[model samples]
Target: MSLPSVLLRLVASLAFATLASSLSHAQSGEPGCRPEMAGHRLPIQRVQLAKDEVRLTFVGHATFLIETPGGVKIATDYNDYVRPPVTPDIATMNKAHSTHNSRRPDPAIKQVLPGWDPAGKGAAHHDVTLGDVRVRNVPTNIRSYEGGTDYDGNSIFVFEIGDLCIAHLGHLHHPLEPGHLRALGRVDIVLFPVDGSYTLDQEGMLEVLKSLQARVMIPMHFFGGGTLNRFLARTQELWPVERREQPTITLSKAALPTKPTMIVLPGH
Candidate 1:
C-alpha cells in the first residue's frame, strides 16, 4: 500500500476507537476522553525579546528549552530527568517511548502538547505557531519486537524558530523514506540519537542527516563510552564538528551554519 493509504487506515482506526471509547464511557456514566483540543492548540505565552540573543538551554538528552528572538520559550521532549529542569512557556512530548513523554511536567509551563495530537478531528497534522516561531511534527515508524509490524504512527518533531528550523528525531528506529523527507520540509539543525540501541544506529543516523541536509547536527542519547566519538567521526568526514565548552549554546538564524556542521554540547 502507498504511504498515504497506510496513514489513512491508521487514522481511521484511531478515529473509530476514539468514538467507541467515547460511547462506552457515556454508557458507563463517566466523561469520555475529551476530544483533543481543536487544531490541538497549545497555550501561548509572551516574552520580551532582548536585543540579539536567542538563548537555548540543553536540558540533557533530547530535551531543549529554546528562547526565540521574539521571547517565546519552547521545550522539546521535556522528560522528567533533565537536571536543573526548566519550566518553559511550552513543552512538546512524543508518546512513543516512556523517556520522551511525561504525564507530570513542570506546572509553570503555559502549554503542553503531545506531538501526535491532531487538529479538526482527523489524525493530527503537526503545525503549531507561537509568537515568531513555528513547530511541526513528522510521523515515522518504530520497529516492533516479536516480528510484529512497525509502529508507523510514531512521530519525529521539528521546530522552526525565527530563521532556524530544528528537528528532533524522537526514538527513530529506521531511515527516512522519500515521503518522510517531504513531510519534514526544511531543517536547519537536527537533534539525533547516536546510542545505536534504542534508536537508529550511528550509520542510519548519518543517512538521515545526508537526506535532510541540515546545517547543524547535534548528537543526543549517547550512553557515553566511544559511541559519541564514533558518531562524530562518521559525520566529521562530511561535516565540521564544534565541541562546545558549555552544556548550552545560543544562536540566531543568521548565525546558523551554511554547510553541514556538528555542535557537541556538554551533558550531565
Candidate 2:
C-alpha cells in the first residue's frame, strides 16, 4: 500500500522546516533547542506604531527601549540601575561591568540573552525571532580587569525589523575586524558607546563607526555632556549632528536620513 499524495506532501514540508531550523542553529553557533517565541505577542505600547516604524527610547546609560511594530519590546544592555519603565519582552545584557548587565532580571521577560556564556564555555550566540523582530548577536572580546584579553566577553546585538537593521555595540573594547563586518551585513542604524575610555578609544571608535557606514549613528554609554560633546566635536567635520530634545525617536526605513548623521537623544 502507498501513502496518499497529500500526506506525502505534508511530510516533506515538515522535513524542510526541520532542516532549515537546524541550518539556522548551525550558522549561529547556537545548537540544541531554539528560543521559544511564546507569550510575547501582547501589544503593550501606549501608541501603536505603523507597520514600517520602530520606536527607540533612551532609557539611560547603554539601555535603549526598542518597540517594534508587532508590539515586541526589547531592552539593550539591560541593567538594574537603568531600565525601561515597562517590562520588556526581550532583554540583552553584557557582562563587561555591573551596570551593563543585571543579576536579577524581571521575571516577566520572556527572553534574557547574556552576551557572554555563563558556563565558561565559548562565545554566547543567539538568533531569536519573535513577532516580526529578529534578534542576533556577534561575539566580541572585552578587556579584562587584569589587563588581559577576555575573549568573546561582549556581544554586538543586531535587531532586524521593518526593513531596518539596528545594531547595539555592547561594551565594546576594540574595533571590529573583517570577519565581524562580514557577519554584520547592511546596518542601517548603530547605537555605540562614546565614553572613549571604557570602550574603544575615541579614534578607534570613530574608525569603527566609519567602517560600518550606517545611515544613522546614535551615541550611547557616555557618562556626561563633556564626554559626548568631545565626541561630537571630533565628528562635526565628518558627519552632521542632531541633538534631539526628546529621549524617544521613531524611525522607518524609507525615512532615514540621506547621509550619515549623528543623532543624540536627550537622556543620561
Candidate 3:
C-alpha cells in the first residue's frame, strides 16, 4: 500500500534471486565442470544425422573408442586389453579392478582421467573439453577385495558432443544414487556392463538401464557367452535387441530410438 514498502520488497526479492543464481553456478562449477551442458539445438527433417554424428567403437572389456565429428577421439576404461592403436585425445578409466583401470597409460595422450585416486581417500572429479567433445565423470563406491568398501572406486564417464550425450558405466558395482542421476542428466547412448557378478547383476543392471532411459543401450564387460546370452533373453521380451556383426555404431540426435534398444557389438 505504501511506496517505500513496495520499493523495499522489490529490492529484497532481487537480492534473493541473485543469491539463488550464485548458488546454482557454484554447484555446477565452471563451464566444463558440469556434464548437463546445453547448447544450441538444430532441427533436421526425418531421423537422419545431417552433420553432427559420433562413432562408438567397442574396444573390449568396457572400453569404447568414441570418435567425434570434430576429430576428437576418446577411449573409455583404457586398460591394457584391446586399446586403440592410435593415441586418443582423451581417456577415462575406472578403479573397480585391474582390468577396468590402467596402471600405465600412454604419456602421449592429451588427457587421462582416472575414475578414482590411487590413495583411496576421496572421489574423482573430472570435467574437461577436448576439441568439440566434453568429458565429465560421476564417481561411485566399489566393493573392496578384502570384503571392505572403497569410496569413489568407479566412475560413470559422460561424453557430450554434437548435442548428444553418451555415458560409459565404467565397472559400476552398484545402483546409481540420486546425485549420480542428476549429474548424468539425459544420456542418448549408454555403454553398460552386463556381467552379473562383476558389475551390477543382470536384474539390477536392467534397473539401472530403466532409470537412465537412454535411447541406445550397448552391453559390454560380460565374461562369457552364458552371461551375455542370459542378459539378452531377459531383455528381449521388453526392449528391442539388435546384434551387429561389426564393433562400431554411429549415431546422432535424430537417430536415437524412440524406445530403449539393446545393441550388442560383436567383440564382447
TM-score per candidate: 0.74, 0.83, 0.79
Error of 3 at 16 (Å): 82
User: How do the residues 1-268 of candidate 2 rate in per-residue lDDT, one tens digit apiece?
Assistant: 3579889998999999999997776566464423322112223446899999999999888999999999999999988677777789999997646798988889989999999998878999999998899999999999889999999999999999979999999899998999999999999999999999989988999999999999999999898999999999999999999999988999999999999999999976
Tens digit per residue, CA lDDT, model 1, 1-268: 8999999999999999999997787655455323321211234343555545566666677777778777777877776555223357778775435667676877877777776543323233657787777777876656676655455445787777756777888778889998888888888778888898878777888899899998878888887748888778777678899989886677766777878889888762
Evaluate model 1: give its lDDT: 0.72
What's the ranking of the predictions by TM-score, best on top?
2, 3, 1
Q: Specify the poorest-scoring 10-residue window by lDDT in model 3.
A: 36-45
Candidate with the greatest lDDT versus the true structure: 2
After superposing all C-alphas onto the true structure, candidate 1 shows an RMSD in angstroms of 18.9
User: Candidate 2, which segments miss by more than 4 Å at Cα?
Assistant: 1-45
Scored by TM-score, the top model is 2
Clashes of 3: 0
lDDT of 2: 0.90
For model 2, the run of ten residues with the poorest summed lDDT: 33-42
User: Which of the two candidates, 1 or 2, achieves a greater TM-score against the reference?
Assistant: 2
- Clash statistics: count for each candidate: 1, 0, 0
Which pairs, if any, clash in model 3? none
